[model samples]
Target: MEAGGKMMGMQLSWIRNPQVSAMLLLAAAILGLVIANTGLGPGLDALKHAHLPFTVFGLDLSAAHWVTDGLLVVFFFVVAVELRYEFTQGDLNSVSKAAVPTIAALGGVALPAIIYFNVAGADGAQGWPIPTATDIAFALGVLALFGRRLPTTVRALLLALAVIDDLIGIFFIAVFFTESVSLPHLGLAAVGIVAFWMLGRIYRGKRGSWPLRIALLAVALITWWLVAMSGIHATIAGVLLGLVLSPAPAESARERLEPFTNGIVLPLFAFTSASVIIPQVPLSELSPVFWAIVIALPVGKLFGVTIAGLVGQAALRVPKPDRMKLSELIGIALLAGIGFTVALLMNELAHRSAEDLIVEGTLGVLAGSLISAVLGAVYIALLSRRYPAVDSTERTARDSEEYLRRTDSE
Candidate 1:
C-alpha cells in the first residue's frame, strides 16, 4: 500500500494541462493589471512601502526587505526545482531530445541580449532578463489558436526552447541581478546546499510517498528561508524544493504533481507577477528603449533562433526537424520571444537602480510577447495544413495500452 501510494503521487506530479494553464495565466495577468490600476495600485504600493516588523530572532529589519529578501525565496525555490528536474528526468536529461531546443534557446537568449545591450546599452542593460523569458503560457496559447492545423513538432520544439530559455534566465538572475554579496552568508548557503542534497537522498532511499513529500515541505520552506537570509536569491528556493521533491522519478507521483505545477502553481505565479499597470506612457512620446525592446525581442528572437537552428542543422549535420515547415518553424521561434513573468520579477528587483530603463524593458516584454503570439498564430495557421505533426510517442503509448488489454483478455 505504501509503495502504491508513492507511485500514485508520482503520477499526479507530472500532468501537462497546457490549455488551462495558459488561459488562467492570461486571466491572472489581466486581473492583476485591473486590480493594480483600479485604485489597488496605490494600496499595493503603500503596502510595499509600509514598514513591517522584520524580527529575525535577533536581527530586525523592514517589511519590504522581507518581501524582497525573504518571501520571494518561494519563487526561487520553484525555479530551482524546475531546473533540477529538467536536468535530471525532464526534457533536458536526454541529449537527442534536448539538442535542437537547446541550440534554439541559446540563440534566442544570446541575440536578444546582444540586441538589447547594443540598443539599450549596459546602463540599463541589467534589465536584459526581462526580454529573455518565453512565457510558455503565451506561446502555447498561441499554438492553441492554430489547433488542428499546427504541426506537433512545432509545439514540441517551442516547449523545449522555452524550458532551455528558462534555464538560461535563471543563470542570468543568479549572476547579474544579485546585489553585493555577504561572504559569511554565502558560505552558510554552501552548508545548507549540502544538507538539501542529503535530504533528497534520504527521501529517495525511503522510496518516499506523497506523505513523505508533504512532510518534507516544512523542511523545504525552512531551507528556503535559511538560504534567502544567507544572501542567495530566495526564488531559487521554489525551484530547489520542486526539484528535490520532484515525483517525476516515480511515474505515478509525476501524474498528480505535474498537473498542479503546470495548471495551477505556474499559472498563479504568472498572474501574480504579470499584473503591471499599463499606465499612460504616451505612445507619441515613447522612448528609444521601447523601440529597442520592440525590435530586439521579436525580430532578434526570430532571426536568432531560426538562423541558429538552421546553422546547427547545416553545419553539424543534425537530423532535419520532422514535420515543421521553415515558415512555421520560424513562427514558433518568434512566439518563443514572449517575455513576461521573469521580466516583471527582474524589473521589481532592479527598479531602484534603473527605474526608467526597467519601464522600457517592461514595455518591450509586453510588445514582444504580444506580437510574437499573434504573428506566430497566423503564420502557423496558414502552414499547418501541410505539415501536421504525427505524435508517434502518443500513438505508441496508446498502442501499448491496447496490446496489454488484448494480452490480458487472452
Candidate 2:
C-alpha cells in the first residue's frame, strides 16, 4: 500500500509540472494527427462528430464540441483565476509593471492579424484572430525546460505578455464568434454569475462545507448551460465566474482544479482539435490561411513583440537595471509565438463553415507552434549560457515566497 501510494503521488507530481503537462498536450495532438491520417481515420472522425448520448437544456453537442465548449471551460476558468490574481496582487497590480507587457501583447496580436489580412485577403480574412494568441502552458513549459540559468524577470515578462495576449484572444472569441445572442438567456446567465460570485464569498468564510461546494458546482453548471443556449460561447461563462469569485476561495479552487484541467481537460481538447486529416494537395495548392498563419506566428510575433516592448520600455523611461537586453527581449519575443491551444480554438471557430479550411488551419497552427517552440528553445538556451550561475530555480522559489506573502497579507 505504501509503494502504491508513493507511485500515485509521483504521478500526480508529474502531472502538476508545466513541462510534463505541455508534453502531454503535444503528444495528444500528434497522436490525433497520426490517427487522422491512418486507416482508422474515418472511425475517429465519426466518433468526434457524433452527438452525445444525452442533451441538456435542449442542446446536443458532438464529442468535439463537448471538449471545446464544455470541458475546455475549466481551462478558461483557471486562466481567469490567474488573470484576476495578477490584476489584484501579482505582476499586473501596478501600471509600472504592466505597461510593457500589455503593449507588447497588443503588438503581438496586431501584427499577426495584419499579416493575415495582407496574405489571406478577403477570402480567408475570417481567420485573422487565429494566430494572435500565445499558449501560456507551452511557452512556460519551454521556458522551464531551457531557462535554468536565466533571471526571474524573463519569466515574469513572459507570463504577463502571455496573459495579456490571451485576454485579447478571449475578447476576440467573445466578440467575433457570436452568431446571435438571446437576451433572455443572457440575462439569466448574468444572474447566475452574480449568484456564483456571492457563493464564492460565502465559501471563503465556510471552508470545508460540502453543501456550499455542491451549490457552487451546481450554479456554475447552470450558468454555463445558459451561456451555451444564449448563443455566446460557453467558455465565457468560466471567465465571468472566475473573474467575479472572491480571492480566498478562488485561490483554493485553482489549486484543486489545476491538476484536473492539466491532466484531462487540455489534453482532450488538444486531441480533438488536432485530429485533422492532412491535406493531400501540394504546398502550392494549400489555403492562403495556412501560409498566413505559418508566417505570422513566428515572424510577426518576433518583430511585433520586440519592437513594441522596446518602444514601450523607452517611452515609460524604465530604469536600466530593470530593462532587458535586446537579445533577451528577442528570445522572449520568439517564445511568444507558441500559440497552440487558443489558436486552434480560433481556427475551429473561424472555419467551421468550410471543412477544407479547418483542415488547413489545424496543420498551420501545429506547424507554426512547432517552429516557435524550436526557435525559442534555442534562443533561451543561448541566453542561459550567458548567465550560468543565475539559478532560475532559486529565483522562482524566492518569487513563490513573495507571492505567498502578498496573498496572505491581502
Candidate 3:
C-alpha cells in the first residue's frame, strides 16, 4: 500500500506536477545561462576545450565534443527508440490521430526555416536552419507545474506535436545540414542498416534477453561510427540503429526503457549538451542572428503550431482536451517554441562558418526558451480549473499501446 501510494503520488505529481519538473527544467536552463554569463567565463571555455582521454584508435577528442557526439548519441538513441515505439503502439498509431500532429509538425518546421532564412540569411541565407528547433523536455518539464490543471488530451497532443517536430527536425538535419555526402560511405551505411535489420530478425527470439541486447548495442555503436564517418550526422545513425535494434512490439521491453529515457537520458543530455557559455553581450546591439533566432523560435513555432492545430481541428475535428478551454491551447503552443536542444544542434551545423552567429544564436535560444516557459507556466497556473484525472490515465494507456504498435510495425 505504501509503494502503491508512492506510485500514485508520483503519477499524480507528473499528471499535475504543480510545475515541479517544469520549474526544474527552467531553473536548470536559466542556471546554464547564468554559469555562462557570470564571472567563471574563462573557466567554462577551458572546460569546453579540455582534453579528455576519449581516445579511440588514437583519435583525439575534447570534453565538449565528447558531450555533443558521444554522450548525446545516447540521447538521440532514446529519441529514436521512442519514435519507433510511437509508430508501433502510441499516439502515432492511427491515421486519424497521427494526421493532425504530423501536419502541425510540418507547418512548424517550414515556417521556422522560412523565417530564419529571410531574417538571418544576410549572407545568402546560410543560417536558415537555426529556428527549426523545439526543445520538448524543457517545455514539458515546465508544464508539469500545472499538474491536474492540464487535460490529458492536451498533454498527449503537446507530446505528439513535439515528437512530430523531432521527426521533421531529423530530416532537415540529414538533408540541409550535411556539408557533403560521401556516396560510397553512405552506401556502406545503408548496407549496415539493412544487414543489422536482417540480423535483428534472426535475433528476434532474444527480444527480452539481456545478453543479446548487450551484444546488439555494441553492433549499433559500430554502425553509428560507420554512418558518422560517411559524412552523415552521426545522430541519424542513432535513429536508424533504433529501427533495426527494436524489440518486437508485443513485448513489454519499452516500459523498461522508459524510465531510463525520462530519468537519465534526457537529464544527462540536458546537463551535458546544455553547457553553453554566454558570450559577452553588447546589450546595446543584439545581432540580426540573435533577433532572427528570437523571432524564429518562439514566434515562428507558436505561429506555426497553433495555426496548424486550429486547422487540423477545423478540417478533421482533431479532438481537443476536455474540461479546458481554448486558452490552454495558446499556452501549449507557447511552450512548443522553447527550442533548446535541437536549436543548439542547428546552431552548431548551420552557424559553423560563423562562430559569432553561434554565440548570438545561443542567446536567442536562451531568451526564447525563457519567455516560452514563463508564459506557458503562468497561463496553465491561471487557468487550471476543476477536472477529473481520468483522461490523463487514459492517454497514458493509449501512449503505451501506440508505442507497442510502433516497434512491432514493419
Candidate 4:
C-alpha cells in the first residue's frame, strides 16, 4: 500500500511539473499527427468528429468541441486566476514592474498580426489572430528546462508577457470570433458571474467548506452554459470568474486545478487539434495561411519582442543592473513564438468554414510552434553557458530575506 501510494504521488508530481507537462503535450500532438497520417487515421478522425449523445443546457457538441469548449474552460480558469494573481500580488502588481513586458507583449501581438495580414491578404483577415498567442506552458517549460542559470527576473518577465499575450488572444475570441450575441442569455451569465464572485469572497477563508465549494461549481457551470448559449465563447466565463474570485480562494482553485489541466485537459486538446492529415501538395501550392503563420510566429515574434523591449528600456532609461541585455531579451523573444495550444485553437476558429484552410492552418501552427521550441531551446542552452547555475532553493531563500528586509525598511 505504501509503495502504491508513493507511485501515485510521483504521478501527481509529474503532472504538476511544467517541463514534464510541456513534453507530454508535445508528445501527444506528435502522436496525433502520426496517427492521423496512418491507416488508423479514419478511426481517430471518426472519434474526434463523433457527437456526444446528450445536450447540457443546449450545448450539443462533438468530442473535439467538448475538449475545446468544456474541458479547456477549466484551463482558462487557471490561466485567469494566475493572471489576476500577477496583476494583484505578483510580477505585474505595479506600472514600473509591468510596462516593459506589457509593451513587449503588445509588440509580439501586433507584428505577427501585420505579417499575417500582409501574407494572407484581406480575404484571409479572419486568420490573422492565429499567430498572436504565446502558449504559457510551453514557454515556461522551455525556460525551466534550459534557463536554470538565467535570473529569476527573466522568468518573471516571460510569465508576465505570456499572460498579457493570452489576454489579447482572449479579447480576439470574445470580440472577433463571437458572431451573434443573445442578450438575454448574456445578461443571465453576467448575473451568474457576479454571484460567483460574491460566493468566492464569502467563502474565501472557508477552505474546508465543501457545501459552498459545490455551490460555486454549480454557478460556474451555469455561467459557462449561458455564455455558450449567448453566442460568446464559453471560456470567457472562466476568465470572468477567475478575475473576480477573491485572491485567497482563487489561488486555492489554481493549485487544486493545475494537475487536472496539465495532465488531462491540455494534452487532450493538443491531440485533438493536431490530428489533421497533412496536405499532400507542394509548398508552392499550399495556402498562404499556412506560410503566414509559419513565418509570423517565429520571425515576427523575435523581432517584435526584441525591438519593443529595447525601446521600452531605452525610453524608461532603465538602470543597467535592472534591465536585461539585448542577447537575453532576444532569447526570451524566441520563446514567445511558442504559441502551440492557443494558436491551434485560433486556427480552428478562424478557418472553421473552410475545410482546406483548417487543415493547412493546423499544420502551420504545429510546424511554427515546433520551430520556435527548437530555436528557443538551442538559444537558451547556449545562453545558459554564459551564466553560472543558481539553485532555486537558495534563490527562494534570498528572495524571502530581501522581501523581509524591504518590508522592515518600509
Candidate 5:
C-alpha cells in the first residue's frame, strides 16, 4: 500500500507538470498526423473501428468509440473537479469574480457559433459548436512558456473564461448532440449518481477505505453505462459523478486520475480524432465547414471574448484595479482560440455522419488552433514586455500564498 501510495504521488506530480502534459499532447497529435498520411493509414483506420469481443450490459462499441465515449470520461471528470474547485474556492467563487469571464465566455461561445453559421450557411451549419470551445491545458501551457512577466491576473482570467467555456461545451453536448433519450436508463443513471453522492458523504476523508473506493468506482462505472445507454454522452456521467463526490474525495480522485487523463486519455483521444486523411481538394474547393471553423476559432473567439469582456466590465461597473486592460483582454481572447481538445471532440460529435466534413473539420481545428497559439503567444509576449517582471513575480507569489490560505481554511 505504501508503495502504491508513493507511485500515485509521483503520478500526480507528473500531471501537475504543465510543460510535460502539453508536450505529450503535441507529440501525440503530430504522430497521429504523420501516421494518418502514411501507408499505415488504412491499418490505423481499421484499428479505430475494431470492436472488442466483450460487451458491457449488451453494449458493444468500436475501439475509437471506446476511447471517445469511455476514456474521455476521465478527462471530463477531472475538468468537473476543477470547475467545482473554481466555483467554490478559486477565482470564480463570487459573482464579481465570475462576471467578466462568464460574460466573455458567453460571447466567446455565441459569436463563434454565429460566425460559423453565417460562414458555413445552412448546409454546413451543424458544426457551429466546433469553435466555441477553449482548451485550458493548451492555452495555459502556452502562457507558461512565456515565463513570469505576464500578470497572474491574466492566467486567472484565462482559467475562469476557459472553465465557463467548458461548462457551455458540456451543455451543448448534453442537449444538442443527444440523439434520443431513454428515461428508464436515465433514471438508473440518476440512482447511481445519488448512491455515489451518498457514498461520498459517508466516506469523505476516510483514507484507506478500499471497499468504499471500490463501491464508488462501481457506481461511477454503472452511471456511465446508464448514461451512455440513455443516449446522452457518457462524459456527462463523469461530470455528474465529479460534482456529487464530496470535496475532499473529489480532489483526491482528481489528483490520482489527472496523470492518466492528461498523459494517456487526452493524448490518445487527440491521436485517434486527428487521424484523418488530409483532403486532396484545392483550398478554394474546400467546403464552407472548413473555412467556417478555420476562421471562427481565431477571429471569432478574439472578437467575441474581447468585446464581451469590455462590455461586461462596463456594465458591471467593475472597479479599475479589478478591470482587465484592453491589451490583456485581447491577449486572453486570442488564447481562447486555441480550442484543441474540446474542439476536436465537438467535431467528432458534430460531424460523425459526414466523413468528408470530418476530415475538413479536423484540419480546420488544427489550423485554427495553431494560428491562435502563434498569435496569442506573440501578443502576450509583447504585452508582457510592458510590465515589470519583478511586479509580476511578487504578485504571483502573493496570489499563491493567498490561495493556499483559502484552501486550508476551507
Candidate 6:
C-alpha cells in the first residue's frame, strides 16, 4: 500500500509540473504532423474519422469526437475547479485585484475577434474566436523558462489574466458556438447538476465514500449526455458539474484526474486535432481565415492587453505597488498569445464545415503560437535581467517572521 501511495504521489507531482506538460503537448502535435505527412497518413486519418455507432445514446461519433467531446471533459473540469478557486478565494476574489485583468482579458478577446472579422471578411467571420484563447499551461511554461527573477506581480497578473481569458472563452463556447438548444435536455442537465450539488454536500470530507463517488460519477455522465443531446457543447457539462461540487471534493477530483488529463487526454486531443494534411497551395493561395488567425493571435493580444491593462490601471487608479510596468504588461500580453490547446479547439469548432479552412486554421494557430512563444521568451528574458532573484531561504524566513508578528498582535 505504501509503495502504491508513493507511485500515486509521483504521478500527481508529474502532472503538476507545467514545463513537462507543455513539452508533452508540443511533442504530441509534432508527432501528429509528422505522421500525417508520411505514408501512414491514410491509416491515421481513417482511425481519426472512424465512427462507432451507439443507438442507446442516439450517437454515432468519430474517434476524434470521442477524444474532443468525451476525454476533453476532464481538462475542462480541471479548468472549472481552478476558476472556482480563483473567484472564491484567489486573486480574483475582489474588485480591486480583478479589475485590470478583467479589462485586459476582455480587450484580449474583443480585439482578436475584431481583427479576425476584418481580415477574414464575412465568409470567414465564424473563426473570430480562434485567437481569443490563452493556453495557460503553455504561457506559464514559457514564463517559467525565463522568469526566475521576475517580480511576483508579473506572475500574478498573468495568472489572473489567463483565468479571466478562460472564463471568456468558456462563455464564447457556450453562447456563440452552440447550434440549437433543446429545452428538455437542458432541463434534464439542470436536474443532474442539482443532484450532483446535493451529493457534494453529503459527500464533503467523506474521503472513503465510495458509494458517493459512484453516484457522483453517474450524475456527471448523465449531465454530459444530456448536454450533448441538447446541441450544446458537451464540455460545458464538465464545467457545470465541477462548479457545483463542493470545493474540497472538487479539488480532490481535480488532483486525481490531472495526471490522466495531462498525460493522455490533452496530448491525444492535440495529436488528433493537429493531424491535418498540409495544404498543397502556395502562401498567396491560403484562405483569409488562415492569415487572420496568424496575425490576430500575437499582434492582437499584445496590443489589446497592453492598451487595455494600461488604460484600466490609469482609470482605476491602481496602486503603484500593484500596477505592472508597461514592459511587464507587454511581456505578459505576448505570453498570453501562446494559445495552443484552446485556440486549436476553437479553430476546429469554428471551421468545422470547411475542410480546407480547418486545415489552414490549424496551421495558422501553430505558426501564430510559435511566433508568440519566441517573442514572449525574448521579452521575458530581457525583463528578467532587470530584477534580481529573491533568496528562497531568506524569503521563507522573512514570511514566517511576519506571520508570527501578526499572530502575536492578534
Q: Go through the candidates in order and give each one's C-alpha lDDT.
A: 0.62, 0.89, 0.66, 0.88, 0.88, 0.86
Candidate 5: regions farther than 4 A off: 1-12, 390-410
- Quote the lDDT for 54 in model 1: 55
Candidate 6, residues 33-134, lDDT tens digits: the string is: 889989999999999988875653786688998888899988999889888877877778898889999999999988988999999999899889999999
Error of 1 at 164 (Å): 1.3
Give the Å shift of residue 258 in candidate 2: 0.7
lDDT (tens digit, per residue) of candidate 5 on 1-410: 42475456554564656667777888888899889999999999999999878887878989999998999999999999889989988899998899989999999999999999999999888899999999998898888766358777889999999999999999999998999999999999999999999998977657558898899899999899999999998999998898888886786677578878888998999899888889887999999999999999999999999999999999999989878999999999999999989999999899999888888999999999999999998988888889776565775577456534533432
Query: For residues 1-410, could you state the per-residue lDDT of candidate 2 as single tens digits?
Result: 32353344444655767788889889999999999899989999999999967886699999899899999999999999999989878899998889999999999999988998999889999999999999999899899888877877888899999999999999999999999999999999999999999999898778657798899999999999999999999999999999999887676677667789988998889999999998889999998999999999998999999999999999999999889789888988999999999999999999999999999998999999999999999999988989857555876677466644533543
lDDT of 1 by residue, 228-274 (tens): 66555766655555555534332323333455555655555554454
For all predictions, the C-alpha RMSD in Å is 5.3, 3.2, 5.1, 4.1, 2.4, 4.0
Provide the clashing-pair count of each candidate structure: 41, 0, 20, 0, 0, 0
**In model 3, which runs have C-alpha deviations exceeding 4 angstroms?**
1-28, 52-55, 207-210, 249-274, 277-279, 317-325, 386-410
Worst 10 residues of 1 by lDDT: 401-410
Candidate order (TM-score): 2, 5, 4, 6, 3, 1
Error at 1, model 5, angstroms: 7.4
Q: For residues 101-135, what per-residue lDDT tens digits would candidate 4 score against the true structure?
A: 99999999999999999998876789999999999
- For model 2, state the Cα shift of residue 98 in Å: 0.8
Instruction: Estimate candidate 4's alpha-carbon lDDT, on a 0 to 1 scale.
Output: 0.88
- Prediction 6 TM-score vs. true: 0.93
TM-score of 3: 0.82
